[model samples]
Target chain A: MPTNKPSLKGKLPTELKVMERLALVEQFLAKLKVDFEAAGFRRNRLVNDGIADGLNLVSNAVELLAEESYEDADRICRVAWIRAHFARAIFDAEMTEHFLGEGVFLELDDGGTTDWRTFASEELAELQEEIVNLRKQIKDRSAKRGKK
Target chain B: MIDDVAKLLSKWLSGQRSNKLMSTVVEAMTEARQKVRASDSPFKSLARKCIDRAEDAYQEAIYQLKDGEPKLCFQHCKQGLKYISMAMLHLSDLNGNATTFAIEQGGADESIIDLSKAIAAFKTSVEYTNCEVTVEMKERLKESVRLFFLAVSFVEREDDNEAKRCAHGGLLYVYLLSKESEEKLQSNAVDAEALERCHGSAISRIVSLIDELSDTNSTLQEASVESHGRIKLYLDAARRTVDRCISAYLDNESDALSQLAKAGMMELRMARRLIEYAKYPTSTAEPEEEPIEEVDQPTDNFRGRVARLQRLLRDEDEEVAVVRRLGVVNTYYSRARALFASGELSEAERYARSAHLDIDFARQLLLDKHATYSDLI
Candidate 1:
């Protein structure tokens, strides 16, 4: 049976907690990558194709976290999170086009086509809820650790 | 014998139209008076008696000029001018102006007080006298005196080029004055001859002084140029080394980063030395020895280089918080290095990432502003 515990010996509880938080960040990044790809966004062409608008901020955060500068890492993460929302909006627009057709979402607003806006709104709401929950979890964990 | 000597003195004073020859005779008479007193001669008072007769001749010349007797006035005025010139020559040794003149001859350090006094004497000689001196002559003498003082002041301030310029101006004014004096007294042969005899030697002395100052100015300018060239080379080398350091750091080449930082420090030191040399081109101070803290330790060397860069950046006047941003990068980089050295790989990686991000931001801002790294330095 696999365990959630780190394999490294003599790990402090705080270090283990930090490791857990980093794992969550990695999961979010991985999900973002997959979603970006599913939306026809190339990983290498994110900067050139203008798909992953917040990739630079994400990359900077990843580098800062690796360098053990938590403050700078946190700062870049906030910027990346905000940019990720913009990326999601772009993804949603692309998805609406791929699913229905170009201008179909606009037609839905004028009562001339399918109600895809409702679906997009619901999807965006779910994504926002997940991001808010994750951000709150990180903040709560940090506050608790600071108190200790 | 005393009466015979007095008669000859009067003849030299009245018959000779040349002030230079008259001055020479007066100087000889003065010297003979001193010699006679030293020899215990019973006729020691004879030389003193001759000077008194010369003074009496000057008084007679003034009276003749007032009486509208141009011929007698010319004779008396020539004698009068000769006496005044002799008096000034004797007083020049005691005055501060003499000290300034001595500076040109490499005799002593110049005193501004003495120089000003000398200039004042020249000015006063033209203005204070009741004698019928020409306005053009007085104006030229005043200008020459002013230029000479200006030149001396420039020399005191170590601006040799300006000193040379002022000296040249003084010489030119003296020449123009001489020409003007000659033109005014062209019809009067006696007066013209007397003016030339008195002022010609003075003009020649000024020319010689200016020539000497020009030589000194050229030597100083050469030294300044050489020092300035060295400063430029050092600054260029410093800039290149700093660029290499930044590249090495970005590439994660630790060894190259450390080595480049050391090289940058050396170039900065050279630049500082060259700047000082440019300021004091004649300074003979030895080059300072490098600190032992810089050598035999890569970390310390890197820190030293960073400190120097910080100092250089802080001294710059920037519209943005460039120094603060660079400081943040440096802080992160140092933390990363320390963590990495201690085997905390994950923690070190995070700090290094922050450093890189900050560096990128700084570089981007600099680029956006169309400024170079040297501008920060």
Candidate 2:
């Protein structure tokens, strides 16, 4: 009988558990490699299937941020973070059709996104007054921020 | 058991020693990239020198280990460690992201995964280090383990207060290691209270730092006497606990290596915390223009900024203080923009100059304050 090899798995960290998942995916791909190639899976084609759904979520987030949709922006912000992580994982796996599902994308309460344009005059005025207090030190960014 | 211990020590040393070489390779590649990015020639010579040193140390360490001179092997390991650290420093200087280590691993979660790996490695090194090595050998292993902990902690996100809470758990991990090693060496029960105190002190110091910043900002908002007292109270409590832990560790009867290893690890964790503070983003709203006469009056936000600046400056860390000052200048500039909008041109000009001067001051202060573990060595 062959001598038993050291069980390195027990010594590994929690992250290695994910690696096992990837390994399973690899094993499956190996069997499907012939079928995949025969079925017209082009090796050169970068597949991003359901990823667009995820990307759309993030894209919507970027839009919300640009629109100063704070409440919506905040909700999308969390989604975008998850989307970015998922997109990265899918990209790593070289999969085309990975995307936003209920399990993948945690739902946030629907609310009006923050509209940057709606900086209430009171809050804006208060911020301005505070700036006046700090005085001469803040002028450094006038050119950068485009404040004439 | 002796052979097993030696084998483990040799393996640990060799792993670190190889990393030293790998770090060199990374440095050379990074340096070349930097030169390409900036079209600058400055890093090329330094990179070449580091590569040569790393190669020499790499060869020497392997030869010594093969010859079974663990002491020589250890020294060569240190040499390799130095070169790797130098490479990392160069990479940091070149504006490489901390996450690049994992990114180069070819995946998104790799960075976090690598962090987990590093934590696991340190934990294993500590667990197996029992009854196996000489006091000196234990110290060396502990030092390497501590360094790895710092490397992991450096990647922690600061702005998420909850993340900070989770991040300090790594510090507790190190404290446990120290306690475990102490128990093994001294054949006495490790003081659970002492370890607990260290963990408690670290958390309290961080929390107090946050509280003080909040209070300072609040006080400055009102420019009130009560606010100042609150800030003072928080700072005093934080300082007492932080100082007591530092003094206790330094004065302890533990062997120099373990004590120093523990202290260095703790300091690195503290440094990481301060670095996180420096990098934390603030609200980026563009302040509207306001009048100069209105500039002298403090607001809650203004006090918050002041409190943050004051707390940052209070950190004994030079780099942290320097970076915080730059942020303070930026905050001032944001205010100036608002002032200028209100036609307070004179006040805006003053704030602008102050921001510039503060940036210059920060640079000087950082140069004076910046230090590394090599400095302790």
Candidate 3:
């Protein structure tokens, strides 16, 4: 029997949760390919043909994870996550004539994101300490800006 | 032929004659076009286009004069002179004959200095304008500077005709910009306030939405998480963009700051849309029911007050001593707010106290000496 894959749905977002979410997205993409093939879909003319372009990102993400490139993997996964969700949204709301592919990926490419709350417990404490130091910076800049 | 047009254009541009004489100015340009038509110069067609523009402006000046808008008439005359001079410059460039049109301003050295000061003032005035206006202003300033520098280089090479032409171009830019700056100064400062308010409002809206979504039920939690990620992502980018804007501000970069601010605002808008969608998937009806937070109102009021006070002071010939105190008040308030946001209450309170004192002093001075400006107080 296959074990249940870790997922981010219905849970708080954190570093660990993000990692698990990446795994979940990878698993979904795999399942989607299998299901698409089993449903006797053609090679190129599927109704959701646009999603096929996004499949390479998942494999690239898996490859990055295999190389222990956590940061790179996370970046790619975040982009994939943004694109997948965005495409899914458009597909749901859109007319049958509208197609998704490169445009969806292109728009999401510039979303270089930083999840502010994602951190381990120990790292959170360290981050708190750094926040204190960063507070000084905010004060300095604010004071400078405040000066006539 | 070009010399006669340049001389006539120069005299017409001096604003010394009755506006009715503008017809003669157009007649002269029409005569010049006939000369351009007769010339076998390789670039005669280009020269004709320039002279044609010159004639149109002179025609406009006549209408403006008839309308009793002398300032506008003067401006139209200057525009006419600019194109006419540009034609002379082109002709001089083509045929080795120097047909320089004298501009009604400082010499090359003085024009360069004045242009620099004018461009600087233009930048300050432009911040009160919309992003598109600010961008156009920047491009004009850049082109003006380029022309001035080329003029300087021509002066160095002893090419009097080219130097004069470039300096004339630069002077026209300075004149136009100064007029624009005056208009911007006269216009209400509310526009600048509205822009900053829009930005601050977008930020706080996203912040409050994130807070609410953090407490949402499990069924809604997944969608909230996705929205949360996007909001944080956008806010992070906006912060960095703001940092770039500040750097550009300090460095006085004409082009970068507006573009950066635009990009930052775009990011904020994206996050705001995401926050709405995440909070209510497929339900447009709910947002109308949700109360829009007016927390950004305070910041808007503060910044707007500062901007208005600055504009208000410009009209006052005498420097009001207490006016400087408002700057201190604004600074202290901004610092206090920043400190308060970062959880530094005691430090914030200290700044807040200073702000209160300054505000009280400025208000008292305004009430005592300038009763008409009580609203700003």
**Candidate 2: tens digits of C-alpha lDDT, residues B19-70:** 5654565565456445445533333333344445555665776787677665
lDDT of 2 by residue, A61-114 (tens): 333433435445333332333223322332322222212111221111101112
Higher-ranked by DockQ: 1 or 2: 2
Model 3 over residues B216-290: C-alpha lDDT tens digits? 211234456755654566555554454344334323353775676666666556556656777777785433222
Q: What residue runs in model 1 are displaced by over 4 Å at the alpha carbon?
A: A1-148, B1-226, B285-377
How big is the positional error of residue B90 in model 3, measured in Å on the Cα after superposition?
3.3
Tens digit of lDDT per residue, candidate 1, span B120-219? 3322222222223454345344444444434444443445454444444444444333332333323211222222322233233333332332232233
What does DockQ give for each predicted structure?
0.00, 0.03, 0.01
State the lDDT of candidate 3 residue by residue for A1-148, as single tens digits.
Answer: 1112223333334434334445444333434445445544233221143255345554455445434465566555544543333233223222211232211110111100111112112222332233334345556756776794
Output the number of the DockQ-best candidate: 2
Q: Put the candidates in TM-score order, highest first.
A: 2, 3, 1
Q: What value does DockQ give for candidate 3?
A: 0.01
lDDT of 2 at B49: 48
Candidate 2 segments exceeding 4 Å error: A1-90, A93-148, B1-62, B65-320, B367-377
Q: Candidate 3 chain B: minimum summed lDDT over ten consecutive residues — where?
A: B97-106
Better model by DockQ: candidate 1 vs candidate 3: 3
For candidate 3, the per-residue lDDT at B292 reads 23
